[model samples]
Target: MEGTKPKAGCPRAAGRVGESGMEGALVWLIYQRAPGVGRRRMAQLMRTYPDPEVAWRLGKAELAAVRGFRPDIVEALLAVRKSAEARRDAERELERARRAGLRVLCYGTRGYPERLAEIPVPPPVLYQYGPWEPDGRPVVAIVGTRRPTAYGLAVAEQLGRELAQLGAVVVSGMARGIDTEAHRGALEAGGTSVAVLGGGADVCYPQESAALYRQMRETGAILSEQPPGTAPRPENFPERNRIITGLSHGVILVEAGERSGTLITAAHAIEQDRDLFVVPGPVTSPLSRGLYKYVRDGAGLAVSAAQVLEDLGFLPSAEGPLHFTPRGLTELEQRVLGWMGSAPWWPGDLAESSGLPLPEVQACLTMLEIRSAVRRLPDGQYIRIG
Candidate 1:
């Protein structure tokens, strides 16, 4: 069994594999389609058995011995396993997924996301479609109202663009307003982004985001816990929210009114111990109600993109390169940098040559110095060091 490769259509095991090794993925597939079985229930079973294959081997009487599995859940589990129809359906679904070229990852698959596994009751099976790989870049989730005001849209797009430009992965639900603009910003910046869907991985829910969905699948990923062909039901959004936050180190709330679904994501972030930051918007706007309240209750305020990075411990409070991106430099800083060469140029000369004010030039020089792109000479001259 040492070099045994999982043959095509052979369901790879998550934890300990039984004789077949296909039990884990197949059982998970069955449960995904089975009624009365869900994430929490699956989690409970995993707690006791450690592997779906092990759980699958348990008879009805033995399964009843597992604590915390309610009678109904136990009954459903037994029923699903015994029903031949259920197994055929799960196999058919998995086969469809395979034919579609989608990646159906069990929890312990080689390519499964680590951050997602850290959450409480993480999805047993994650359906992914796109090029997704682990990278050193940090990930941040941005959530907001579906019906965002002009201001909210601007802020969401700005956050997405800035975060992506800094080489951070932007995560968001592919909903309307804020989510749409956020993903668009990431794409515009040529950055990686992940969209967690409330519906099936292949179904573009809003119908309008179809093009964006395809674009994401091309460059990034569009994934969901829901099985393929599953409709976007009202109850599925909250379930989708947990995954959005779980995959990121931090969550940015751009705009959310009271009772907004965005709040559900925020709650998940808190439960997962992910950093929470809220963008402060105009108090007059109803969209800001939930976000402003979070700030009031002690969430980090997103005054700028730098603040979020700094809070994540990616930035130096005093001075340093701070993972500076060329695109992130201020306009004046870019202008000042353009004027520099191997030779040192004092701020006075730079301002005069670039047609910028001396004070602005000096400010840019200081910023550049802090960024470690320039070194300050004894005579107050600046030279590009990096």
Candidate 2:
């Protein structure tokens, strides 16, 4: 949450323009629709004319005089300003968003994401659906391949669940494979999860993710820089990666191949100076090559969600309620722990109940004891502990 404050002089820093909340948002939408006005150009225009309304009223001569405004760019702005159709489009877009119950945030306005505003070329207009708000809690992003190995899937889901349980907001692109699992885990834990889409906030790219798309809109949020009704084009994803990392305090790469698009997210994280963590997959896996390269290049090695929370300074105090979930436990250990309760039970009884060999049960109990998750009593019984 550090460094998330909105920069001074951002457009509409005094909040919404006039009495209508959508008035400032409409100006941004109009500017965004202007041809040749990309992220950088839009940023420059906003810097020169903090009030977008002022920019809208500028004549060709005045607009052309602004820094970085070429003849063509100025002409596009002027044309868009003069076209009645352009204004109608912006108005219809806002009306549609309102009917859909979506919130439109113009850059530097109240309710806009402060972290996103800190990016070099933050989107001039953002469309969001949901009620979740950034409350200074840690925001961690989990990203990886669309086609992941079983190991990768499990790791991504477990990490998501643990991070959510620890009170950190989870973020991903809501894509297939790892991203889907990550969101699922967070929702399963009754925690917030945000999806940054490459298309319009209302569109779900992969038809298979329709369920997830709805769930996120209900429990978390769906965000996009693209306007309503915009399709998710191939090129939009790379640009969308920036918003994903820009909103996070840190990013965790679960599993990515050498040429995985997930690496794009990692690059954005590095450029944004956000903490980068990589969950090491098997070196033999083709999916893991990209992750190891980042690890070698100084990214933090993330073996567990707990380690990530600790590295990002999100670990709760010892005096707080002990809800920390242990990570890195073996499958057998997890099974044994699931069967444990506050009531004391002999190791033999646990083995019979869990249908595991007594020796293996005893070994798991010893490991659990060493981890301070269980305490052994003088009566030859064990009780679960924090």
Question: What C-alpha lDDT values do all the predictions have?
Answer: 0.76, 0.79
Worst 10 residues of 2 by lDDT: 9-18
lDDT of 1 by residue, 124-197 (tens): 77778889665435688889998898988998889899988877788999899999999989989998889999
Off by over 4 Å in 2: 1-21, 47-51, 57-66, 315-386
**Cand. 1 TM to true fold:** 0.74
Each prediction's RMSD over C-alphas, in Å, is 12.5, 14.8
User: What TM-score does each of the candidates earn?
Assistant: 0.74, 0.74
- Clashes (backbone N, CA, C under 3 Å), per candidate, total 0, 0
Candidate 1, lDDT over the whole model: 0.76
